[model samples]
Target: MESSPLSALEQRLISHLQVLYPQTDAGELARQCLSALKLDAKTPSPQPHRNIWDQRDIMLITYGDTLRWDDHPPLETLHGFVKTRLSDAISVVHLLPFFPYSSDDGFSVMDYTTVNPSVGRWRHVSALAQDFKVMGDLVINHCSSRSRWFENYKAGVEPGASYFYEADPNADLSNVVRPRTSPLLREIQTQNGIKHVWCTFSHDQIDLNFENPAVLLEFLSIIYQYLEQGIRWFRLDAVAFLWKTPGTSCINLPNTHEIIRLLRLLIEHKAEDAVIITETNIPNRENLTYFGNANEAHLIYNFSLPPLLINTLVTGSCDHLKNWLMRMPPAQQGTTYLDFVASHDGVGLRPTEGLLTEWELDNLINTMKRFGGKVSSRTLPSGDIKPYEINISLWNALSGSVAKGPDQWQFARFMCAAGIQLALEGVPALYIHSLFGTENDHDRVEHTGQLRSINRHIWNMDDLEHALNTPTHHQKVFEAMVRLLKIRRGQPAFHPNATQYVLHMGDRLFAFWRQSLDRRQSLFAIFNISDEPQSFNLAELNLIATDEWTDLVSGQKHEDLLGKVTLMPYQFLWLANKVGKLSEPN
Candidate 1:
């Protein structure tokens, strides 16, 4: 068989997959997948490719309160804010679901072409896209049942419509599985009344019929319109469920992968600078598929990460996280992974859910219930319930309320989470809220209760500014995040293409080292995830050179050959080797 001329990342992906699934013809399958996409081959190629996204490329998540702030803040004020606070470290800003939509936090698209009036007009969005590196949501997996596309399709509006997926009139929903575990689904009646529309999420969000060539073309046109308007990044939402067939869960389907590859080719041809990011919130194993051949999605969300962060904290161990990283398939050198601790949505329990044994899960559930009817754990168990329960009991005894008090400890915990993520080999995306230590928005519970509750709250600039300027505990956490961002941006070892190796540090701490292929520069990161201090011997690593290295955060330099290094509770260190002469300080 002739070898394929795939990109570096694609080759790495294929090699990793071959090891996992030995019998499958990974390369041939990838080629076939690329060939089946709906893209035009004539599109131009992107230029000025970037290896990693910077801390200045912070993705500020905006919704109700944030949008309101944007409306009130003078353009110059917003611009100045970005320039001063984030310009050097941030490169991109992602606005969440600004399109016209009906439900599920604006996932239901009433119109792909227009922005929701509640946030701003399409022109305002276009202006922002022109002024800044912006990315918008492309919810092609489904549409608002109220949208003209769905309405026209339901009314049988010939070629002008027919853009939705229509099931057999009498198809059963009894066995249909929803994203959530619930069995109740909202069904829409077509004009014939005999045929009903299947909504995977809610009645308002009707699944789009990607099987139709016309539908694909329509969406392609929609994408071009945005590209022309200066939207460089298209976050493909819920792509996993785009294609459905009987006997399958309709996720990560072969056709869906093909569609993504085709779209990548088209984007490359049309808007060369534009990129597609898939919002596949699956396990690490399945998430790699979205980055097909390194040519499909330019970026994939580290969906399993947030839970891993939480698990590491509660377990006081990095075993699960290390295992997950070891299992991650390598991608193209230039390609970047989007790592984050949280986002506009709630924390997902799915990724780490299966990692826990049934007994462990039940114990966690019971602990949450007993503590305050909510899941809460500071670290994972070393042996079993006795040690785990003792840790939680100690936490409860020392801390008055998990929700409040001991703010520094909470901030440290959050920092520990951020440290591991920023050190990982990927483009770290810090959710604006998380940076400022915004906890669960319990007040928005009612809004999230509604079909599209996630989009209900407005952005409060005053509140955000206040939090940023104040001396609150959350503010401290934000400062720590900023420090790490600044450090990561200054170090080349943190680049996306740098080689990564996970170190086994006795479970309590997760340590990793990133070095240039030529060994010109190197960075070693150690994170103490547990509440107690932990020490590890550096001699075991046998790093090429351990001479005098500077602690990026503390400005302290060590030149000792000591075999031991101790990390304080929830502390982290970013040590870079200082060779020859240190250039004039920035």
Candidate 2:
């Protein structure tokens, strides 16, 4: 007798699981996993139903200094801000690392179930989650060494207390080099004196022992609790390092993927709308795998975005941007990439390294050093320097703070970035500060003395008042972002997993189009990244519209004009044809 097709797929899946977890009940687990997948297929995936992510669907990320909720303003105050200011364009909110932690901008979780008092209480968080209909961080990858789990392991408390991944008691610390160069190490003492636990990035952030089923169950329970409170999304922090082996780099291991797949399957089965977003801050190549054929994370952060923004800014070219876009595979049937410019953490150099040549990196370093004031000398091996001034300037530029420059130039850069994010085949994530063109908070850095100190400041009503009345740089940036968001919300082509590609324009410009299969509606986004004005022939667009179309940005209307269109310096236009026409295939 031959096995059925369903049983055959189940058998193959069980065999795959056996290779990773040899001791587990593979057959039973496979049956459960299949059932879960079937259940998920019956339920609707938690995503926006429309083609474009509405401006109101934007996710405003707030961390450290920007945690205005910490001041205990009435919950209605925050709700009103979201409702009135971004009601049309913004939909979700991401509060970064509100859990208690030791260092590295709250990556070290002391307690998974509780929110840090500095931000708010669990009750407040629960209330906010209910009000906003959003979810937040689930730092299951690592925990602070001071956490109760770690302490219980150290004290040898009963009921699987010794489950933590501990270093060999006889291992020599003198020979063991620390993973990071920071001086924040705190050695844990076992029965046989001190033993060095692995703290991959920070000494205080002790990696959890995922090899233990207890740890896995504990995290699952926590997730279920948050789901009860209305958390529809969970950002799995530092997921790459969750599983480890002695010989390998211990990142992106097979077990890690399996665990993520299992967790995703379980969550989708239990709660229909909840999603798991993997925070694998790796290169594009490595980050792609986190999606796991759309079975792992529902979304992964597009780490390549920041560097692309910087590259376009410096070289005034869209070649690298085009290459990156062309290289990205379409999001698997249901999943989407969470794209953004600046995040709550520091701008990473890993993704940009492959995109930039040695000479380009050197030029970038020199430029940063020249512009960077107090923080200019800090350099990386790739020749990129963390010039504080350049960082602040770029932040200001994006936020619309520095307004005296050519409006076309500033607006061009702003619109170009926004176009890429919105037109891309994914959910575009907007950082809260980016909306208002918020600059680096130097005051917060002085207070926290951490690399991401600026991320911690909270928004004050007084500051908003001042910016609105005084017409500061941030005010203009904020207004521009709001306008772009409003326009994007009204469009239909900017939906998740839409077919997109970079247009073959000159190096100084970037262009892409998103269209439906029937060609009833379409969006064309062209950006001029260069400081000097650049032009492109509209004939190259080969759009199928016989009627005139209007430019959303300049409010200018023109006919196809024999297949020719020209763009101004740093300008971007979203031209749409209401006649249900498609562009001629390239």
Q: Which residue segments of model 2 deviate by more than 4 Å?
A: 1-20, 24-56, 64-77, 158-160, 168-180, 183-186, 369-412, 563-566, 579-586
Across 1-586, the per-residue lDDT of candidate 2 in tens digits comes to: 9854544445456665676668988776666555533433234434432222322355667663352433464333455566567765666677677677777677888877776766656566666665464758888767887788777767767432655666553443333322245431347776556756766666777777877655665776677777766777889988887887764556788899988887775676666667788987666898999988777888889988776776576567778878888888888656778888777765555566577776765565454334331232233323344332123334533422111222335545665677667667777788777776665576877887764655344568666757755767667877777777766655656656656767888787788888754555676788777666676666777766565677766677767545455566567778766422221111
Q: Write the per-residue lDDT of candidate 1 for residues 352-427, one digit (tens) a residue.
A: 5456666654544444334322331221112111111111211221222223324346556667777777778777
Q: Where in model 1 is the C-alpha error above 4 Å?
A: 1-58, 64-67, 70-80, 158-161, 169-177, 181-186, 362-408, 447-459, 543-547, 579-586
Positional deviation of 392 in candidate 2, in angstroms? 5.3
- Judged by whole-model lDDT over C-alpha atoms, candidate 2 comes out at 0.64
> Each candidate's TM vs. the true structure?
0.81, 0.83
**Whole-model Cα lDDT of every candidate shown, in order:** 0.62, 0.64
Query: Which prediction has the highest lDDT against the true structure?
Result: 2
Model 1: which ten-residue window has the lowest total lDDT? 383-392
